[model samples]
Target: ENNEVVYELLADMGWTGDSIDLDSWLPVYCKARYGGCPAAMDSAWQQFRETVYSSLYSYPRFTWQTVVPDTRRISKLDVSDSFLQGVELFLSCADSLESSPLYVNDAIEYASYYLAAKADDCYKRALKEDSLGNRVAAMQQLDRSVEILLDVDKLLASHPLYRLEEWVDMARDWGKTDLEKDAYEANAKRLITTWGGFQEDYAARFWSGLIKDYYIPRMKLYFSEQRADLDRWEENWIKAPWHNTSTSFEDPLQSAIKLVERYKGE
Candidate 1:
């Protein structure tokens, strides 16, 4: 595992440590960015710069400079739904991780994007009435989503056992509606079956986490009639029938990957 992580880290940085490249784009770019540093500083600088570059312009129009959430504010906020939703937006945009640690570090960010957007809609309605009760409710949703993000982030970063499957089990144990449990089970199984290899590739990793852990399960809630066989369903939640987008990368996951690659290239 240690060697694998090292190899991946080096490959990501265009390092040959010893292999010959049949086709390489990262080397020249690496030279351009870090050729001036001392040998000892070169690798470190390259890693740092690579992370920053990927974080900003890797997807769509996302630039690393884009502001989302301040982690320091997590404890200070009133725990309102809208505020919590903002935290979700932060996680969705890949703001929680200090640098380009790994795609999973940004897991919460992606989850938050969906959750915060929904919470934001609720807050809009609550704004019309300006009722304390609605305001509190909205905040509660945001807070819950944030809490979930925190857990997912940690799982993605340090623990392989805490996969989406476990999340489904948690939902079931929480004694959610039968409809919810069924939906959760179906999606969790899909993730495990489709992309559970623990592969190091970012695309595979992101898809595994998002599809299995978040997207499909969330859809189950909308179907009041419990689905006995969710595997038979062919709906694409990322590009749901209700979502309208003129761009090919408008799908949230795709957009996020693009952003990551963009930042890496910089």
Candidate 2:
């Protein structure tokens, strides 16, 4: 009976038949059951989703950089209009689930919310550290932001509901024979193109190369010199060659594929 209930809960999350990994889910199921029956599990899921949504939407449209006086110097990079729009779109998509369900499996949505919130928190901490003139601490927070945001694709690839490789493999297989693209193929291409295209306003990212090679180094350059003129320092830094090169800009779909491939090899 307990096993049956666990399976039923998995079914609710769209995992069915042999696709359900009981071993991976048993601990979560047991923990959920400790509170009560199936209702407990359902309530827990709802609470988790709600918490993620709330955290994501709690920040203003332009975020902490705009609100905080100290961060105004680097406000453009810290909270760009493009970054805010991407975040808004992400949050909006998550919120839409409340009124209209789209996907059969919402694990990807949950992961997206969790990752975006985590990245935002890291960015806020970085700004706080910068305001305090603690370059080392600020870089640490920025590193965390990179880690969190870059892991989003990994989460999607591994999660049962949104198996990135599986979808890619299936799409490739179908493309080999089918002249007409299916809905899944079309949707997948659209998501990749839309998120990965030249339009920077739609996609948000803090990938590994951009962080370690770019943002961290850029911050180092900022802190290397001791300047009395805060305004001049900021102005000079923004105009610096490294600053323009180190900006957080990349193809999201390509990054996702690279990470997915790395995961597969590992």
Q: Give the number of the best model, judged by TM-score.
A: 2
For model 1, state the Cα shift of residue 57 in Å. Answer: 28
Give candidate 1's whole-model lDDT. 0.34
Total clashes for model 2: 0
What's each prediction's clash count?
Answer: 18, 0
- Could you give the C-alpha RMSD of every candidate to the true structure, in order shown? 15.9, 15.9
All candidates' TM-scores? 0.22, 0.33
Best-fitting candidate, scored by lDDT: 2
List, residue by residue over 134-210, the lDDT tens digit for candidate 1: 54554454344334333333333233333443444564565478766666665544443333333211122222244
Among all windows of 10 consecutive residues in model 1, the one with the lowest summed lDDT is: 61-70
Q: Which regions of candidate 1 fall more than 4 Å away from where they truly are?
A: 1-223, 234-266
lDDT of 2 by residue, 1-266 (tens): 11244365557577444465544564455344332223333443444434322233222222221222233122222232333333333333322232322221232333344454555567677778888989899878767665654565344433333333444346546564444334445454334222333431122222222233323343334434542443444344323222111122153333333433333211
At residue 52, candidate 2 shows an lDDT of 28
- For candidate 2, the TM-score is 0.33
Off by over 4 Å in 2: 1-37, 45-105, 158-266
